[model samples]
Target: MEAIDGLIHGFGVAFQLQNFAACLAGVFIGNVVGVLPGLGVMTAISMLLPLTFAMPPVAAILMLAGIYYGAQYGGAICSILLNLPCHPPHAVTCLDGYPLTLKGKGGTALGVTMLASFLGASFGIVLMVFFAPYLVRIALNFGPAEISSLMLLGLLAGSTLARGSKLKGMSMTCLGLLLGTMGTDINTGLQRFTFGFPELDDGLEIVALALGLFGVAEFLKSVNAVAPVSTSATRIRIADLWPSRSELRTAIVPALRGTLVGSLCSMIPGTGPTIASFMAYGLEKRVSRRPQEFGHGAIQGVAAPEAATHAAVQGDFIPTMSLGIPGDAVMALLLGALVIQGITPGPQLITEHPDIFWGLIASFWIGNILLMVMNMPMIGLWVKLLSIPYRYLYPSALFFVCIGVYSVRSDMFSVGTTLAIGVFGHVLLRHGFHPAPILLGFVLGQRFEENLRRALLLARGDLSIFVTRPISLAFLLTAVLLLGAQLYFALRRRDEIQLPPSASPILDE
Candidate 1:
């Protein structure tokens, strides 16, 4: 009943003319960024952060949240029409989206993706409305021991579940954790890794790091790559936008499954849309009656991942809002924005700032509806954007990256830091390193260390508190189980590879 009252009040706030307009503007910009290759939600939000400094807190958050999910909708356009992903999560869409395009079903694919994204987002928002409060209530019982252990689980899950070698992911996570420790220590008032620089005491700017890793690195990579060219030109009519009855039937179940998977994954800190999308695709493949069709224009292939990614995007708000813990780097930025605006996110957020909490929730539904309505009509426009030359796009994006980083603190140091990190990020990418885990680690590192130290201090330097507390023990045990599972799968794969050729009946035959 209390939640219901708060939601109603939130709707009242979100319906205000100014807040509504902000929501519209955010989704509009987010959509544009999402349609452009190499521009991710993180980059878009990071670049836009400085602009939000002067806005009212609720309106600023509503707009930022609008951009976050709006990008999820826009990313599908490039993935379907150009065999390019505007964001990392959309990369999975290419498996079937481009194949559908090749088959002259691009319009249908786009329409289905839009619908799936809407359904997924709606489902996630519903879960958020109901589950977030409960999670917050539970979190209120947590001590420093539990918080520390929980953060460890998040970090471990992030590194272990990321695509590619777990070892490499862990290595990147360590790098991020180290980077995160480069500021002044809260307890001692002493700078740790500042190297005698005053600016360093405040810590490395997240905007600089995000722009460097995602924007600059992407710009460098895209500049050298061949621009994609459409092999055929076809004007899709409105009549062609709807999928066939059979295709719709085939996609329905997968979309639902994806929504469930993504919503659950979003609740787990450190897991983001990319992992959710891939997991959905993998599950769809496994359970599909005709798995062979997956890579060759299966309707479910496009539907499942699209739904999962969008759902995950919305679902991330659960942890971010309720526990004040960011599920990913983008959420970290959002949290930072809230903190900058003198708003603290946690269990009390709902009680103390009901308008902000409820209003933001209401805006999510509105923004998603706007996305659905706007995306369908704008499909042709997004497709047309592909014909624009890469050279033109890259320079404009680079300009924003530089300007955005510089604007963060009105300092040239951040600009230099972005450039340096961009070079370093590019090098890492060239060597098969993933940057996502690093960002996740950096975001959670400070909190993890603070809580760990606090817990130890409270326990008089006894580490057994972590094991004695049921909640802390549960999180730690979960982390161990996850790691053990990864090792088991890795060893099994290695064993299969090492088996003698003669031991295989197919080879012997």
Candidate 2:
């Protein structure tokens, strides 16, 4: 009943004319960015965060959250039409999605992806709405010791979650924490690693780093090589718009299965769509009547991964909005936006900012529906965008990277720092180090440090407080168990001189 009232109030807030318009605009623009490779929901949301300075919090978050899941639906358009995944998780969609395209059943694949995405997203949001109350209550009372232990668990769990060696992941996490430490120590107010450069005082902008790492690097790689995109597609007509009943039935079970699995995995910090899709795909195959059809344009294949990814996208918001723990790059962006808007995301946010919370939740259903519309008949426009050649696209991308970086605090030092991070990120990329764990660490680093300091201060530097707190102790023990299991597998892998199947799928690029 409390959940119902919150949802009702959310609808009340979201129904305002201006808020409705913004919701539509956000979802529409989300599709545009989603179709464009590298301009993820995080980039789009972060770039647009400043624009919401004047808008009501309800409208701003509604639009921002709209962009979140709308991208999930819109990304599939490119993955299905072009072989390139719009985002990495959409790469899972490309597995069977592109194959379906080759068979000229692309229309069916797109429809299934859209429907499954909507349904799975809805499922996740419903769970979040009801579960948030209980979750938030428990999360709110967590002290500094509990928080620090949670961060430690998240860090170690992330090491096992992300690609590469546990040691390498630990190294990357430490490096990110180190990099994150550069600007100024909040506690001491002293600059550490400025290197005497005035620009180093502000540290590196994530936008520039991300733009270069994902946006610019992708452009550079594309410029020198040919990427696969279908040129012979007969523009899909409306007559073939909807999926057949048989096809819908084929997709239902996979979508449901994906939703169930994706929701569970999403609660784990550091895990995201990459694992969710793989788990969903494996689940489908395990229960499949025709398991051999996977990777061969199976509708279930397309539906399962798409559904799981959508659920993951929505479920990822759980930690971000409730516990103030960012689950991914996009959540970090949302956190920044929340702070900039003077709306802190924590346990009290639900009670203090009910209008913002509910409004954002309600807009999700609207944004998802808008995405379905965007990806269908309007897909023609999105696909037409792919026709714009690399020369033009690269310069435009470079412009955004430089401009977005410079726009933040008018710092040229940020641009320079970005280029350095980009180059370093590219090096890490080549060396098989996924930059995600670093991002996770950088986001959590400051808070982790803050919590550790606060806990020590509160306990008068007594380390026994962690062991005395039952909640903190439980979290610590869980982290230890997870690390022990992960280390065992890692050692076995080293002895066999082979990578884990989950970490490296031979079929992946």
What TM-score would you give candidate 1 relative to the actual structure? 0.93
lDDT of 2 by residue, 440-472 (tens): 677677788999999999999999999999999
How far off is residue 261 in model 1, in Å?
1.8
Q: Would you estimate the TM-scores of all the predictions?
A: 0.93, 0.91
Best by lDDT: 1
Model 2 clash tally, residue pairs? 0
Top candidate when judged by TM-score against the true structure: 1
